[model samples]
Each structure stands twice: as structure tokens, then as C-alpha cells.
Target: MLVAAGVVIAALTGSAGCYTDPGYKGRPSDAWIAQLAAPGLDGRLDAAAALGEVLRLQPNAPKVVTALVAALADTSDPVRVAAASAIRHAGRGGGRVREQLQRDAVPAVAALLADSAHPVVRTQAVAVLRDFGPDAAPTSAPALAGALSDPDPFVRRPAAEALGALGEAAQLVAASLARAATRDGDFRVRRAAAHALALVGGPPGTVGPALVGALRDTVELVREAAAEGMGQRGADGLSEWTVPAAAGAGDPMAMLRATATADPNPRVRIAAVTALGLVGDRASRPALRQALADRDATVRREAEHALSALHRRGGQDPGMEEPSRADLCRSNPGGPGC
Candidate 1:
């Protein structure tokens, strides 16, 4: 084994020479690559971690990406976990590296998502897929959707969460998420499903009704996620409460107000305040003002920020318009209003 390591190191530094990034002070010796395939678990695990650092130092190198791709199938659980982590580092660059991940590394990681015996591997695999962005469709969407059915919450949570990252491609699985949001046994899975639904977006009629139903989930966290999804309906003019009208006064604006003002969980109140700002609902001002005194400092701060955003928008209204730098600076990232 020692002689084999020496031979491998020699090759890395030979005519074909090792690849090195600006931060990489030395060539990535083949010994590290060999360790990746070594019989000892620690050697393989350490190799995966070392490769992660190499990728960080010299990102977008296809050679390392190929090596890490092979590591994804390592029988040792730790090595697979480490390899998944390293894949993220290798695939960080948007162009070539992302393309490499899409072609080489990503498929291997996607395969791991179905490994029901190891939930951590699935979670790490989801992390890698999250970077695929919208282009992840035609493949990752279905794979991620399938993960939502995994028995382990650790696996199901990320699968449900990754679907939202697909953007419009999420439409492929939006109905599935709607079902998961309402019926998943675990509160975390349901909460994640509800939150993901907001990002995937759909006709307010279909998506909105599903999310509203979640708002009344016995679990307060699920309700918080449902409240958040309504605010994120973007600029669409759809009513957020039509589906739940029969259930009672399901006006989302009203629900946001109620949750912001009365939920026992301070964290949920904090999310409610942030959502009010995103929804641009000026009518929520009174409840938000009351939230200004919330026991949780985070809730108080979110309330204040929401009020400021509302105030800025109000200044933009026709008759109430002002030339104050506040709203103007909002259009631009930094200025006097900032």
C-alpha cells in the first residue's frame, strides 16, 4: 500500500501534472485520490474532506469533480457523506463547474437521494441538488418529489424543501407538495411542504387553497408557514382565502393579522410580521404597530421593519406621495434612505 501511494503521488506530479488553484500551494497528489478508494474508512473519509478543500482552493476543476463523482458511490456511509459535501464545493462556480455537476456529479448525488437506508446521505444529496437552480428540472424535480415519500423525516424534509427551489419547474410537483403539506404526518415535513409551496407558486386557486388549509393545521409552526406562503403570492391579485371561505373567515390578510397579533409562539409572530411587509398590506398596520411591543425582540424588530416598509410604500401613493429619500432609496440598494 505504501509503495502504491508513492507511485500515485509520482504520477500526480508527473508530465500530466496536478491541477492547482490560486490558493493551492501544491499539486493535489494522487495519494489523496488513492485514499479516496482506500480500504480503510478513515483514509477514504479524509480523502473526501481533503478533496473538498482542494475544490475550494481551485474551484471548477473538472478533474476533481470527476474524482468526487466516483466517491459518491463509496460503500462507506461516512465517505459518501463527505463526498457529497465535497461535491458542493466543487460545483460552487456557476458556469463550467455547474455544468460539470449537472453532467457528472449531480446524477450520482441524485441516485443517493433514493437511498432510504441512509437519511443523512439523502439530506446531503438534497443540498447538492439545491444548487442545480431552475435548470434542475426534467430530472431533479421528479427525484426530489420522490424523496418526499421517504419514511425518514430527515429525508422527506429536504425533498419537500428542494422542490420549491425548482422555480416554475416546481409545477411538476406542486400538486404533490399540496398533498404533502396537508397530509404529511410529521409537523416538520408538513411545515417544510407548506413553506416550499410558496416558492413553487401556482394558480392562486389551486396553490392558495392548499396553503390556506395548512394555516389551520393543529401545529402552530405549520400555520406560520402557511401564513408565509400567502404573503409570497407575489404581485398576483388572487384572493388567498377563497378555498377556505366555507371553513370560516379565511381572508389571508385577516389571518396574517390574527397570527401576528395572537399566536402564542413568538417566532411565528415574527414570521407573520415579515409576511405583512412582503404582502404590502397597509391594512395590517395596526396589528403590526401592536407587534412593535412583542415580547420577543426578533418579533419587535421585524414589526418595526415591516412598518417602515409600509410607510415607504404609503409615501409612494398618488395623493400621499413624497419626494423623501426613503422610498426612492428602496428602488436602489443604498442611498440616504438606506
Candidate 2:
């Protein structure tokens, strides 16, 4: 049997031991490129592994990148998987090399999301898209958005996560993500979607309600992610939350406060307390103060930070100097205080 399986495993996962073809030792990049087109699965797998090694040493090698991009479409699944893995490795760092891959390889890898028959290949394809982050957003977002509805949760979770990695560029698909967050059968997918909704900056009118609904998920991690997303959206985002009356009466801050005080999970409580600091006004101080007495030390610590933020927003910092009379007079003129 070809060592192609080992190469695929090691390339997909970093834990496997290294595998090298002794015959190709000391071969030049051109030699590996040629071998990629050679007959049989063994030769192609070896070439894919060698090119990945070259990429690790010289990430900017144009010939190696070109060869790998071509290999992504190879008829053999192993070769394609290995090729995607190699491209993923080259994209681990940000610079000219990764930028080149973004322009060259993203579309090809994205095609695999829709065309590949194997779920593993599709999963690896999503991983490559994610490794490119925001740079891959323009080409990869639509494909990734479609992958959210895939039957496999393995693919769905990563697709949601990849969209999250796209950041604000993914706003166009915010509604799709909101649906996944609220209705996905898998909690892992739901958690990833919740986190993505926070980063993707969809219409807060849509995203805010989805996240609030997620707070009631049966899974604690999903609830925790929703609370964290609330904090990430901050005050401006929170202002647009238009949930129905049955769902906290459209008041996200109140919902966060209730979660901080009542959630069974300490991590969820911590996230809720932290969110209050980011979105809450001076009125949130009472809830934060109450959180300071919680059993979990982290929740109490986050509560302290939230209280500090509230104090700073209200201009109550202990080190703040009182406004000067001249300064007040220049601004107020006809008013009692400036």
C-alpha cells in the first residue's frame, strides 16, 4: 500500500510522524512538480508531501504554490486532500505568500466545498478557507454560507467558524447565520454560529434577537457563546436589538443582567457580567455590583471590571480632576453647569 494515507493524515493533523520518500531526497522543486503529474497515487502523494515541506521552508516559492493549486483538482482524493493541507500550511502566516494563495487558491478550494463527494475533503476545504481568514472572505463567503446547511455537522461547524473568521465582510450572510444559530440541530454548530453572528456584524435587528434566543439553549457552551456575542456587539449594536416582548422586551442589557444572576453555568455568568460592562450604561452598575458577590472568582472579577467601565463612562474615575471654572464658563455661558 502507498504511504499516501499516512501523508494525508499527517498533513490533515499535525500530530502524525513525518513521512518522506527516500527516492526523492535532495530533489529540486522542479522534480517534485514533475512528480505531481506522474502516474499512480504513490508518486502524487509523495510529491504533495515534498511540496508541503518546501512551502514550510520557503513560503513564497511561486512554483510550489502553483503546483499545489493544480494538485487541488487531482483525480485522486488523497492527492487533493494533501494538496489542500499543504496550501493550508503555507497560509498559516500573513504576508506576500498568503496573499498570493488568497488570490490563486481560494476559488479552487471553494469549488471543492460544492463538488467534492467526500465529507473529509469538504471539511479540509473549509479548513483551508478559514486559515486564510478575512483575506479569503470575498471569494469564500458565499460557498461557506451554503455549507452551513450541509447535512454533516462536522462541515457545518467549521463553515460557520470560517464565516466568523471573515469578520465584517460576512454581513451579507448574516440572516443565514442567524438561522443556523437558532435552529441548528447540533449544539457545536449552534455555538459556532452564535460566535460568528457576533463577529459578522449582521443587522443587529436580526442578530441580536437570535443571540438572545440562543441564551436559552440546552447546551451551556452555546449559551456562553451567545452571552459573549452580546458583549462583542457593544452598546451601538445592542441599541438595535428589536426582540419581541416575550423575549426580554427588546432589552438586551436586562437579558444579560438576568443571565449573570440566574444562569446555571459559571462561564455563562462570567460572559454575561463581562457583556454588561461593554454595553451597559450607568444604570447597569447595580447588577454588576450584585455580581461581585457571586461564588465564582472569575465572575466577581468580571463584575469589578464592569463596574469600573460604568464608572468611567459616567466620569466617576477617582483620578479625574474637577472641571475648571473658566472651562465651565467658556462652554456653559448662560447655563449653571457645563
Candidate 3:
């Protein structure tokens, strides 16, 4: 067992200096391992990063496990996220590590689930937590449900995905997700809620109506999710809302023109203009023509290009009929986009 443990230690540590003695003369000490496991916050991201490296290197080390549990219990959010990730690796067997985490009751990990300020981190944390499976303690259920309403698309999306892992608790989460689908400020959040509903693995025929209602969502992403879900259930007669572009508020063509004419969030504006060409809403010509004159080069280009595409295609954009084969993946805006 010691030899096997040593081999695992070597495999885990690899090139890290933690495997060797301070002067390359003796076995690594508990003190050294503990130091590497300590969570650092006081603007010492490097220190936390180093500790994470050490934990990653020694998945089965009792000392490493002890240090990680301590880190998971730390007050610092970043440190907690690191420890949770490290523990996830150790717990790949799916029982002891999860039990340890549940017993720790670290709020930092929960708080990280709602950290919209950093969307990427929030998404990644949610993804890791969901792997804990249906047996995850009930104490964390409310926290996961609350995240369904997160402001950041990346944060809320993953929260939806995580809720799916809760098994029976998923019914409770579905209520929260439903509320978010209709009321959340971010369209992406609503879409995530809708997608998460499907992932519950319940009766598809019964859930179809709720998903169909989401088709009317103001944001394209939500509409897309709804449309895709409806398509999967073989529901037809989805009028007004059709491939690529769906009508809202007024005539489909007119709405597209106005959307292209106005609407903040440059990406949304651009997508709206593109939708006009796909829908072949000719009534929007005036708006599209004017959009071609806008100062923003991309918007102008999209407007002109879309107008040309519409004219050539004779209305109605192509390839809007497909639905995703799998459930919606939680948003992940790691790095800058988050």
C-alpha cells in the first residue's frame, strides 16, 4: 500500500517541486504539504494557485486531504473555489470526498455560485458542484435554487444545470427556474432556465407546454431555446415565431426593422438585423437601409449584408429548423467574457 501510495504521489506531483525535499535530499514533510495546502487571500493569488497545484498533485494523501478540507472551510471565496475543485478531484470515486465537503458546510463555495461579478468563476464552480450528484446535502439545495435568478448569464446558466443534478429536489428547482424563465432580466438566464427544465428527465410530453411558452420570451436566446424544445417534442403550428427570426409586438418584418433601428447591446442589435434577412421581412427595408449608414462599421456591414441576403433568398433565412440533441450546457464565461 505504501508503494502504491508513493506511485500515486509521484504521478500526481509530477514536475512540481512539492514532491522533492527542500534541498532535494529527503522525503516531503507534513509541514511543507500543509503550507502548500493553506488558502491565501490577502492579494496572494499566487500562493492560492500554488496550494492548488500541490493538492492536485497528491489526491490520496491524508495530509493533502486534511489541508484541502481546511481550505474548503476558509472564509476567502477564491480559496474555497480552489479547494472545492481540488476536493472534486479526490472525490472522483463519488462518496467520501462529497461527504467531507458536505460536512464542511463552507459558505464560500455557496457564495461563489452566486458570484455574478465574476461570471466565469461562478459557472465553473457550479459545474464542479453538480458532479456531487443527487445525494448532495439538502443544506446546499436552497443556495443552488437561489442561483437560478442570478444576474449574470454565465452564473445563472450553470446554476440551472447544477439543479438538474439534485434528483427529487429538481422539482423544487423547476419552480424557481420557471419563475426565472418569465421574469429574469437577462434573456440568457431565462433560456438557461428553460433548458434546465428539460434536463430534469421527466415526461417530455408534459413539459412541452411550459417550454413552448418560453418561445415568446423577448430575447432571442430564450426564444431559440423554446423553439428548439418545441421542435424536439414534435409540436407544430408555431406561428408568428418561425425559424431564425420570430415576430414580437408587431408585424414580423416591421419588428425586425425597428429592432435593427434601435436596441442597445450591439450584439443583440446585430442579431436582430440579421434576423430580418432570415425572416424576409421586407417592411423593414427602410430601417435596414438606414442601418447601413450607421457609424458602427459592423452594424452597417451586417445591415447591408443581411439586406442583400434577404433579397437573394427571397425571404426566410435557411437552417433554423434544427434542435440541440443534448440539454443546454451551463454558461461558461471563463477569463474575460464572463
Candidate 4:
């Protein structure tokens, strides 16, 4: 009986040793927190990673939030990266916890955006700001705008996306976003900037010109994004673009009409057609009609939908003649309008 009891006791001890608690009940153990300050890199890395898991399980813990915020400024880039990423994960928690995490960690994470020595750290920092959503905007926008100039396209892309996530609160940086949309070296950065510009771009006047200009970008994606942004900007956004050719704003309507009817990529044409349908009036019928005959069936389908939308709005104008094909060609020489 004694031998049997010993075996049962040993089995219970072995199972207890093997049992891994999925997470902490409240604050993590002090030993785990101390590991974050351990002398060796591996020890600190492991601790930071473990804390991320802890955050996943106990996302509202103030102690874990404090430890991770401190880790954002750690001596090692990987540790800082892990901390920023962990904070971003934690920002996904329930309402009060997400708000608290953003309030506590935004400044620290925003500071990392300037860590030029480590682009990966900056990238992760923007991601945290991005995940925090609009709440992080007021404090983090300027830093994110600064990141648009980072030498890395990867960093710039997410920074633009983060600013976009901030929505209208990020209006102060509209000019910066405009510059990135029209002039950034990378197509991906340019695309992201254009998408963001549509959201936080303030008024049509501030962002319209840049988005219209982006329609001329060599990359089809950039042009498509520009077209979509114009559509999102609505009537006021397209007001400047739709003026008669003689108004001397360089005939933006003609350009948009040309894009709708003649852009080489069917996706771009579809986007342009959609934009014209949303904002276009009687003057845009010619381009929409031309799109109806596009080689791509999708463009034709979008054109059909656009025409229906136009009819629903009672968009026809008695005074404005549908520009003749010859006139369209004259306004945009060598385009589908021609």
C-alpha cells in the first residue's frame, strides 16, 4: 500500500510539473517581470514575448501595460519591436482596456517612429499606432507624418495607413499626405498616401489637386486609387475637376473622362467610370457611354451601373450638350476620348 501511494503521489507531481497555465489570472508573476530586466538579451527577449502572451490572455492588466511600455524603449531593437507589437495586440482588447492602452502607450510608441537606427522598430511603431485607430491620432499624427520621410518604403506605407486610420483628425498632415501621394518614390507608398488622403484630406481644395494629379501616375494601382479617392470625395471633390475646359484648371474633367474611356488597364477604367458616375452630371455621359463598349466586360458592367445611378439622380442638364466625341478627342488628344 505504501509503494502504491508513492506511485500515485509521483504521478500527480509529474502532471503538475507538466501543466502549463494558459495565462495569468491577474498580474504576471514578479519573476517574469524581472526577466524583462535580466542581463542577457535572450532572457529579455523571452520575457517580452511571454508578456505579449500574457497581454493576450489578461489584456487589461495595468502592470503588464506598464512593463510593455517600458520595454518600448529597451536597449535592443528586437525587444522594442516585440514590445510595440505586443502593445498593438493589447490594443485589440475590450473597450476600456483598449482606450487605456492607447492613452498609456501612444507617446512611447510614437517616440519609436524616430528610431532611424532601426527601421523595423519604426515599422512596428507605426503598426501600433495603426492598431490603436483614431484614438492615437492627436498625439501620434505628427510622428506618423514624419515617418513618411523614413528611408524605408515599408515604414512610409504603414505610416500613411495609420494616418488614414485616424480619419479626419489627421487633417493637419494633409499636405504631407498629398506630397506622398503625388511625389513619393515608391508606388506602394504613393498608393497608401492616396487612400489616406481621401479620408483625412480635410476639404476638397486641399486634397483634390493631388489626387487628380495622381491619376496620371505610371502605375495602374496609383491611378486606380486616385480615381477611387475622387469618388469618395464626392461632388465638392469633383467640382474643380468637372469645370469646362475653358476654365483653365487644365481640363481635369477631360482628363477624368479620358481615364474612364481610354485607360489601358480595365481596372483603372472601372474606377474612373465609377468616380464619374458618383460625381459626374450630364457632362460625363459621353465617357460613361464610351466605357459601355470597353473590351473588358467588367468595365461595361460598371458603366451600366454608373449610367443607372446617373439617371436616378436626375443628373441630366438641358443646357450642357453631351460633349461630342470629336470635342472629347480635341480636349484630350490621343485618348479614348479622341
Best candidate (score: TM-score): 2
lDDT of each: 0.72, 0.76, 0.51, 0.74
Better of 1 and 4 by TM-score: 4
The better candidate by TM-score, 3 or 4, is: 4
Q: Summarize candidate 1's per-residue lDDT along 1-338 as a digit string, tens digits.
A: 00110111111122223445542235353557777878889878888888788888777566666677787777777888898898788655666556666766666778887677788888988888876777867677877888888888888888887887676677778877888898999999999998888667665566766776676688988988877765676435334333445555445556668789888988778778888877777777889878978889888877766776777677543433343565345444564546
Give me candidate 2's TM-score against the actual structure: 0.78
Candidate 1 backbone collisions, by pair = none
As a TM-score, model 3 comes out at 0.49
**Tens digit per residue, CA lDDT, model 3, 1-338:** 00110111211232222332221113353544445444436433334444445545544343454455455445455665665576566544324433444544233455556545555556655765676566553655567788776666667767775765564456645567666666677777778676565444233333434454564456767655543333232212223223233323323224345556675545545765665555554556677778877767777877766566554445433422221222111111232222
Candidate 2 RMSD to the real structure? 9.6
The segments of candidate 4 whose C-alpha lies over 4 angstroms from its true place after superposition are 1-29, 94-96, 232-247, 250-255, 278-283, 315-338
Top lDDT prediction, candidate number: 2
lDDT (10s digit) by residue, model 4, range 1-338:
00110111111122112323345435454556678877889988888888888877666555566677777768888888887787766765665555556666887888887677788888888888887777677888998999999999999999998898787789888889989999999999999898788667564555656766787889999988877876766675454344445545445556678899989998999998988887755678878888879999888877776765665467443543454556545434675635
Tens digits of lDDT, candidate 2, 116-173: 3678888998998888777568788888998998889999999998898787888888
The true-versus-predicted C-alpha distance at residue 318 of model 3, in Å, is: 33
Give all TM-scores, in the order shown.
0.71, 0.78, 0.49, 0.78
Residue 169, model 2: Cα distance from true site in angstroms: 1.9
Ordered from best to worst TM-score, the candidate numbers read: 2, 4, 1, 3
